[model samples]
Target: MVVLATKVYVSGDAYERSRDALRSLVDNEIGDLDVEYTIGVREDNFAIVTIEGDDEVVARNVLREAYGEVTPNFEDGETYLGTLESWGEDGIVLDAGRDIEIPADNLGLGQGTPIQIVERFGLVQHMPLRFVYREGDGNAGASELADEERDRLYDWTRGTGRVNVNSATRGEVRATVNRAGHANDIVTVERLGLLEQSIVCKEGTDPPGLLAAIGEYLPAEIRCVIP
Candidate 1:
């Protein structure tokens, strides 16, 4: 079983839809392989995929490549994936089967507290981020956002702009965009996690304006990334 880094925390219909979508995604990821798989979400909200068959190893690796895995151990200086859990004036916490804190100084996003950077990057809660793990004293561990991950967030600012949202599926976000009559204002609805999404705005489109137009239609938290 490989535990996925992303979370599926919403309940009822949302949970079912996310799970169905996730299953379809997984099917597409390993459809060519000779493996049978089943998926489950742990109490911690991390997803686990159990694979069995001749091509299990290959299928598992494919799943890991598509969705980073939550391992039972972390080697010093190695990179891993974690879901954003909470943030404060000090820093942010990631759920990697355990609490992995990336303090403000280590965020590498520049010029602000952790929450400030989160806002600047339009990061929604539950989004998966990559980090390099460092072993610390008394069995404690520390992590910093991986260089590639930091680079990815930095790239967002160079784009037209985006509206980050949480507690909704990609389909729901897209529907909200259409319902608000600003469907043509977006380039795409990018999935950040099972419950997190980014609405990439088109050139000359205003992300804040887009957010205002669709915010009321979504029963979720929304934030804008202005360029």
Candidate 2:
């Protein structure tokens, strides 16, 4: 069994739709192989995938390559995917099975407190982020966003025409955009987390315009990443 790095925080009908979407995603990734798989969402919101077949090892490797795995223990100098749990004056807490606190000083993005950085980046609660773990005294591990990773995320905002939506499954978001008749405005919807997604706007399309077109149907917080 392999736990997906992404989190699933949606509930009710959206939850069921998200699960079905996840299953289809996994199937698209490794269904051609001689393996049968089952997808389950844990209490902590991580997706657990169990594969059984003679080619299970190959299927497992394929999944690990596509989606980072959620392991119980993390090693120093290695990067892992973690969900944003909470933010405080001191730092941001990530739920990576264990709570990993990233101090404000370690956030090398720019000059700002944790909360300000969260706002500038439009980071949604429960959104998954990549972090590198470092070994500290007593074998405790400290995780922080790498400078390169921070730059990459920052670059996303540098580009105009991206709508960042939170608290809705990818399926729901896509449906809303289509139902709202703004499907052509979007080039693609990138999945940031299970419930957090970024809608990449096509050329000549404004992010705010796309948001306003679909906002009425989504019933979730939608923010624009203006350049």
Candidate 3:
């Protein structure tokens, strides 16, 4: 089964209004599938709605068409948070908020900066509710992919064991590019990591580094290699 993500905006002093809109849209478009909704504060006078569904293609199409009836503001750009250019490749690069500033002592969400929503569309998304891997010897062990890589690399490593990020190792990471009786092209896993990081520029890549192509793709946290 595939899952999809859709965003909805809630209107002023109107949590009820937002809920109604979301319910109506979900009822109409994804009326049949299992639905889970999450609401979070977004800027002023509005909240963000995340609707997750079972079938990705059907869910997205239904939501897009349903906007005509429920919340046209999303289509008219009236409710749009910002254009695509404002978003870096690494999702919404939330630096300091430029528009609003909250007072430190006020005890409320004071003037905060503009909100950037970095919505990543993915299929097999899993959160590490628990981690069991450990280090071996004095040597740092296996490497791991960052949180951001989970979604993009999800499809590639579904049946390929867990995600391994080799950022700490000096030698190359290896993978089989082509196969011949369980043996294929011995590509360095480091190369895959580099590809994922956009460190190397592939053919037809305008920019030299694949990392640059990823646009602001930085590891949220640096993890040492396990021994």
Candidate 4:
């Protein structure tokens, strides 16, 4: 059994849809392998997959590479993925089978308070982020946002700006944008995670304006990345 680093925090019918979506995603990743797998979610919302068969080992590695893993023990200096939990004056908190707090200085996105950085990067709650773990002396481990993760967030700014959202699937966000009559305002809806999405704006579309137009349609956290 392996706990996936990403989460399934949506509830009710949305939860069921997200699970089915996850099943399809997993099948697409490892269906060719000779393995049988069962998907489940923990009380904390992290997904768990149990695999067995001749090709289980290879399938597990494939899943780990695709979604990262949440383990009881995190190897020092090893990079892992976690869901954004909260941000404050001090730093940000992430849930990776455990709550790991990454300090402000270690964010590595630029000079700003953690909350400011969160706003600038449009990091919605429950969005998965990659980080390098640093075990403390006889204490829980600490983490810093990984370079690749930083680069990805930085690239978002270099584009025409975007509206990042959580607790909604990519299809749902796209539908919301269409329902709000801004379908042409977006270039594409990028899937950040199972339930996290980024709405990439067209050249002339204002990300914040698009966010405002569609915010009423989504009952989830939405942040705009202005370029």
Candidate 5:
């Protein structure tokens, strides 16, 4: 399934006084519905944000439900930052339901630093079952799900080991993959940065030219035979 990159421009007169408040409401509500959000600026009574994931229809429905009239816009492709979780004296905590003792510093969660949730499993539910790391905390959570069971509905709707090479009209592969390729691995030979590269693969695009460029510019480990 192709996951789309989406931007939601939420504007309201209540934004000036409650930027974070509005964001929190939207984030929590949408998150409950399993929509991933990357929070951006909190200014001018408007919020600029980007979201990417599989539950597009559910996300739209939740947005309207929470904001009373949220306008959700969809785009073809994206590099997206997964949701961020932070631990502070008064911030969100991992709802482990049990105290798993560990050094606070090891988790990178002394008191106020937010950490990123890298992996998740189970049917997407209002209560997110996340693999989280605190800034100073040391432990990481991972479990091997039976491949057959993983394919079953018990693991929520999130499926793993899938990829999309199709580019968007903006001339790039999914944003999350594109940026990750540049930052974590040296795939595309970029001059400036991953996000700055002018690349796109939209419907009816020239596949041959793109394949040639990928062969010529990208690293061998990152190369692929476009079927």
Candidate 6:
């Protein structure tokens, strides 16, 4: 059994749809292998995947490579996936089972406070981020965003025509864009969290224009990151 790092925090009809989507995703990732798997969403919002088959080890590795494994303890210098729980003047707090705080100075994504960094990265609440935890005395166990990860997010802001939408599932956001008759305006909908998605506008397509066209169809709040 492998506990996935990410959470599935939706409820009602959205909950069911999200579970089905996750199951399909897991199946697609491990279907070709000689493995039979069952996926269960826990009350704590994490997904538990159990595999039993001839190639269980291989299947397990495949799943881990696709969806990071959730561990009960953090190791020094090891990168882990965490959800953005809260932000304050001190720093950003992540819930990786325990509270992992990344100080504002450790953000390393440029100037500003923790809140400002969150806004600059277009990070939505509960969105997952990768970080490395360092062990020390007082501030030891403090986490820092991985340099490569921070650079990847910083690069996104440099490009124009990206629409970042929060509080909606990828499936729902994609359906909304299609229903709004602006499907051609988007190249892909990148999943930032279980609910947050970033719509990458197609070449020559304006992000703000695409957001305006589909704003009415989506019930969630949408924000645009202009280059």
The per-model lDDT (C-alpha) reads 0.89, 0.81, 0.27, 0.90, 0.30, 0.80
* Clashes per model (N, Cα, C within 3 A): 0, 0, 19, 0, 33, 1
Candidate 3 displacement at residue 126 in angstroms? 37
Put the candidates in lDDT order, highest first. 4, 1, 2, 6, 5, 3
State which candidate, 1 or 2, has the greater TM-score. Answer: 1
Q: What is the lDDT of residue 55 in candidate 6?
A: 90
- Each prediction's RMSD over C-alphas, in Å, is 1.9, 2.5, 18.7, 2.1, 16.1, 2.1
- What is the number of residue pairs that collide in model 6? 1
Q: Quote the lDDT for 84 in model 3.
A: 12
| Cα lDDT of model 6 by residue, 141-218, tens digit | 567898877987888888755788766778889889999898888889998766778988777787778878988877
How do the residues 124-199 of candidate 3 rate in per-residue lDDT, one tens digit apiece? 1111111112233221332122234333433333322222322211121121111111112112232221111112
Clashes of 4: 0
Q: Best to worst by TM-score, what's the order?
A: 1, 4, 6, 2, 3, 5
The TM-score of candidate 3 is 0.22
RMSD of 4: 2.1
Candidate 4 per-residue lDDT, tens place, 5-118, comes to: 889988899999899989988999999999999999999999999999999999999999988898888888998899999999988999988888898877889998998999
TM-scores, one per candidate = 0.95, 0.89, 0.22, 0.94, 0.21, 0.90
- Off-target runs (Cα >4 Å) in candidate 2 are 137-141
Of 5 and 6, the candidate ahead on TM-score is 6
Error of 1 at 51 (Å): 0.9
Which is better, 2 or 4, measured by TM-score?
Answer: 4
Which candidate gets the maximum TM-score versus the true structure?
Answer: 1
What tens-digit string does per-residue lDDT give for candidate 5 at 1-227?
11112222233532232345445655665676655766554222123445667875677556544332212321222111111122332223322222222223333312333222111211111111122222332333322122343233222223221111211211233333454433222233221111112222333334344434454332211212222
Q: Is candidate 1 or candidate 6 better by lDDT?
A: 1
| Poorly placed runs, candidate 5 (over 4 Å) | 1-17, 40-44, 70-227
Q: What lDDT does candidate 4 reach at residue 133?
A: 90
lDDT at 133 for candidate 2? 85
